[model samples]
Target: MAVVLAEILAGLGLLFFGLKTMSSHLQSATGRRVRALLRSATRSPFVGLVSGIAAGAATQSSNAVALICGNLVRGGVFTTRDAIPVVAGGNVGTAALVFVAAFDFRLVVFYLLALVGFGFHFKLDRRPAWKEWLWVALGLTLALLGLDFIKQGPRDLDVALISQALDAGLSPGMGFAIGMAAAALCQSSSTPTILVLALMQARLLGLEDAFFIVLGANLGSGLATLVSSGELEGTGRQLCYVHILVKAIGCAVLLAAWIAVALAGGDPEAALAAAGGSGGAQAAISMLFLALQLAGAVTVALARGLTERIAVRFSPPSMEDDASRPRYIHRRAAEEPATALDLSERESMRLIKLLPNLLPDLDRGGADFSTQERNAFWKGSTAIVQAVDHFLVDVIRAGATRESLDIALRQQARLETVRALVDTLHDFSGVVGEFETVPPLAFNLSESLRVIVLSLAEATDGGTGDDFDLLIGLTADRSEMLDRIRRALAASEAGGEADSRRLMHATSLFERAVWLVRRVAVALRPPPIEDRAQDGDPARQEAPEGVA
Candidate 1:
């Protein structure tokens, strides 16, 4: 009994490890393909549906597809509208994986292991790209071997004893609960479903028992997504909500139908009894699982707009989600260089407007966001800037005119300068915030920096050259003033080294910040009149002021 238990335990362990390894490596290997698949969803709902199905089958995990879709949505690659069908399709894909797993790989496992071993010995995994493939192959081999062990290792065990132990058998409700718990723990319905397949093959679980567990596992996979998606914000979690809704509805409908059939005295697991072991029962259950998933997917796909509305209501978009996306610049506009650059500039102004928000305490006039809110804003803004960069790159690649190229170059420089300006201000704000009582020098300097940020924003919005001229004057020749402030800080502190050091660092930040502010002003300064005349846009002589 002890030896048999040990074998079973070992097999289960190997099976779990193998499934995880295979899924993870498969996901990694298919990253680019998966992204391309996601993009294709925008082409058509049907194409997106197909892509989602392909992605799920390739990765062997629908949870992965959900996460990827959410991220892509935030990136503007997949809108919530387009993502629903794709997400629905992933259910079918995962079911496909279960069906594939149900097949007998007992003989192939040895050959697969041998091939993978030779490849590793030959150092195929040493290559950057080939490494993931080899691991994927190895994972598949381990999974097949583990499944074989799970089936064969218990083959000699007494069926009568197993029957005795399960004499009362599992009530459908109990089986459902166990399946739900297993899927939630593993975060994959396929894991629990495959285990059920193994148990049925080993005669440890009846077909009816496996049915309830598989059903529950399917439902639990959606719950597992919700359980794990705490970090996702905005429309980013919309996918998770969609997942749950689809799964919940599918489970209810399927379970109700199954119960109706049973109550009417029809055998749902009739195929399990007629077919051979291993493939037969496994395939039957897998097909049923597929049907359940397909039913939900098709239903959701049909009423996608309503489904999306329900999901969004459940998990509304957050400020961070709003900021993570670009407002003006988009890939389609990149084809027209002048329009794209104009859009990029407008988008940039939005970011500049937020610069003052970075130092909310110093800039009391602006909205006062909590630290967490500020962090979210910062991340969202950063992602937006990244999107801007990608858009600019696309414009350049699409063949811009000399004038547009020149504008692109300037805009690119401006982005880098603003990034530096924001970074310096961010550091300054952190130091000023850390002071127990905001010091006079720190307050004045921060206020000066904040005013300059606001002024820069104003300047870029068609404010007088007076703003730039004054900004240049404010940033210039602060060396003597710095020395006076340092001495005042050191002497006023009454011998505390930490205070002096912090004040000194704060002053340094102030100096760098003003310098960056000047650079930004210069970058945003309108092009010289002569250069504008040389270009065809005689109507566009005034230089556009850049924001924050």
Candidate 2:
């Protein structure tokens, strides 16, 4: 009994670790691609199911696939109807584990262990060639090890004692209820079903009795998924709902078939074994069941597509108009550096207006965010920086007349400086935990950044125009303000309290912001192009900024 118990624990441990490792690896690899696929595939219910199955198969985790689908739905990538099919497909894909484990694969465990150990120990090396393949091998081995333990371990259980207990405790309804609870507890229908099968193989439970339990197991798995999936909304929640409906319907059909067979005076165990014998054919039967599950999923996906089309026909209008959409520098738009510069200016101006409120919004404890919301904010920020950098790269690459090159170089340098500033701001936002530092420093520093950025916008549009004098004035004013902030920060530091470290950090960040603003002013200040041209001096034209 102790040995059997030990095998069970070891098997469970291996199973959990294998699934976790496999899920993490697959998620990291395919997560973004799957997200992209769902955006378009969610058009029809069938497409959703196929995408769900494909992604779930790739990642080996239905929950991850479902959660991602849900976030996409909330992000407006797909409608709830579109998500349903994919989610249903995910349910079918999740059962692929049963197919894999059904095979005899005990020998792979040695390779698996070595690979995992090597990968863990050598992770810091930049050139770990084919490390991923090793991880995959290790995961598959762990899965096989667990399956082998399950198949071989149960024969030694005290069957007669367990049978007596079950006979006293289990009605058809009770068996079904227990099976559902077990599946829910396990969180993987594959595990629960295997456990139930193990129980039967040990002769502790009859086959006929196990049939209702399997029915309960499917329902329980659906319910468990639904309950967990509820934490998400839109496509994710819908996917779980569709999965539940399909399983509930499938179970009803199987349950009725079981009852009919019993009424025909057949033993359920004898019947099941005869239908699919105890040999490799049993494996075939499991595979067939999996295929049927996939077929059901495909059908569900088709239904969801139709449902989505109908919903779209009656969709409501959004509150925000197209004109209200904020424009930012786009990678495609960067081909035209002048256009990119224009977009960047607009983006800078938008950020300036947002500065006062950004900290407050981020700081608000009650600000509710969907996963999509946070992802959009982060992705948008990344995209903005990337687009701007692309523009700068293009400008640098295009070698021009010496005079033109000097202007371009200065502009490029200015952009690089501002990019550094924005990156620092982004870092600060992350450290301060999304707008938690809503104080005067954040406010004033943001305002100063806006002023410099606006000055750049003017400079980019044929050299600061009327704001050239304004830029100079603002630069002098900001210099004075920074000096005051620095003195205040130093005084705060002199107090030498325990919180001085944090305050000093804040001061450092503020100083960085000030420096970025000053750089922006310097970059935007027009060189004496008119004077150099009038003097007909090419040397003066080629001078870098600040040359005597």
Candidate 3:
């Protein structure tokens, strides 16, 4: 009995591991394409349905599809109403894998496929794309083989002993409990459903029991969405809740149907047996699963507005939902270095958007941001920068790949450049305020200062190469003009000592601001694709000065 239990556990472990491997590889191979399809094709409900189905089928994971849809909604690429249909379609598409697994393929065929996949995976000149597909094939083969082993364990046990141990027999309620437990433990509905089907095929489990188990598995599948929603809020959180609610409703409807049938003195088992035995039962269960998914999809699609309203009523926006705080970066995401880095990049971009507001407009005679506003801006900027810095450090410690580390380093440099620009803005604001008190200057100093300020504003407004180049040229012209004015002021007695002092202070601020803007522009621009390819270590190279 111990040996049999060991075998069952081992087989389950292999099955879960195989499924995880297959799903991850399939996502890696097709994730970008699936995202593109979702973005471009989700214009209407029908289009979203088709795209979601295709994405779920390609990736072999409905949860992955839901997460992608959630991200799209967060990014404003899709509305919650539009994402609902796609998420619904993902449920139907996920059912295809279970249908395929129900077939009783020869064991030798799986072994041969696994062997061939291993060979392809180890090939000297194999492409990365081919390697991903080979891994997926290998994982699928292992899962099928494991399913066979799992069935063999129960068959070896005495039927009488197994029935006696179960206590509740092969009743639907017991099956539902068992199914929900297995699915929750595995974090996958497909694994538990497939296992139940295998047990039924081995004659160790009844058809009616397997049917209820599949229903329970459907309900258990919502746990993944529930856990993921903990990290999200606002529209993203609402979308996840909608997904869970749809699955729960479907489960309730199916359970109610079963209860109603029982209450009417109908023998579901007798009906199932009359259909033909286990084979007919399997087909019926598959059809039922698909039907439930479709019904849920249709119901959700018809009442999307109502679903949104309910979700909002439950998860309204909170005070902590301030735009200044980093939305995506969180401690929960630390384990996923790639996602963490991506979040850091997004938060950095938000910080960059504040640059234009920081630049003082001298033509208007004062700074655009009031003193209180500037202080607030500084506080917000510091928080975002520190958050990104801390997040990057965690990503590095989490063992990010070299490529990802390089990207993080680039972001760090950009943040430094932003800090420098902010400081320069502060100094420029102070100088402008001091000049406001002074008398009118000789040698047209105010006009010259205005031109310099305008040029700096234009350069910092856009981080493009052209903008930086124009800034360099303007600064050079201003530098030469400053020298001429200095010489003229020295030769004449009309210009007072106070005027020369103010001119020197303004000149110092203008030069520093120009230099900071140039640095920021360089940090923002990446090396050309070909240049990066040739260098092979573009991250080590310093950002070129005055390069277009």
Q: How close is candidate 2 to the true structure, as a TM-score?
A: 0.64
Regions more than 4 Å wrong, model 3: 107-115, 121-125, 167-174, 228-230, 263-265, 271-278, 317-351, 355-518, 521-548
lDDT (Cα) of model 1: 0.78
Give the alpha-carbon lDDT of every model: 0.78, 0.59, 0.66
Consecutive 10-residue window with the lowest summed lDDT within model 3:
316-325
Off by over 4 Å in 2: 26-51, 71-85, 107-129, 215-292, 306-357, 361-506, 514-548
Q: TM-score for all predictions? A: 0.84, 0.64, 0.60
Please state every model's RMSD to the true fold in angstroms: 5.1, 7.9, 15.7
lDDT of 2 at 175: 81
Model 1: colliding residue pairs: 352-548, 460-545, 460-546, 526-543
Q: What does the lDDT read for residue 29 in candidate 2?
A: 47
Q: Per-residue lDDT of 1-548 in model 1, one digit per residue for the tens? A: 67766776777677667767877887788765655557667677788778778878766677878877888787776589889888888888987657756777667888899999999999999998899999988887776676666656666667778867765867888999999999999798887887777677777778778888988998999999987886887898999988887788788887887778778898756644444345467677877688778888888877889989998999898988876788898767989998999999998888887787777565463247666676677778777777787788878989999999998988888888777776777788778777777666777887877787888777777655556677777678688888898788877765367767888999998888888888877776554564456565756766465521
Best by TM-score: 1
lDDT of prediction 3: 0.66
lDDT of 3 by residue, 1-548 (tens): 78877877887787667767887887787755655566556577788777767766655566667776775565444567778878877777877766765666656656767586567767922887577777787677766667666756666667766555554665777778777777677766666777776666656666677778888888777666766555566665666776676677778776777678778999766654555446575666666667667767667766878977876786664322233367667654767878888887767766666655554444564446665555556545665666677677767878888998898788787777777766676665555555535445422443454455455555545445555565556555356766776676667665467656766676666667666666665555444543445566665344565554
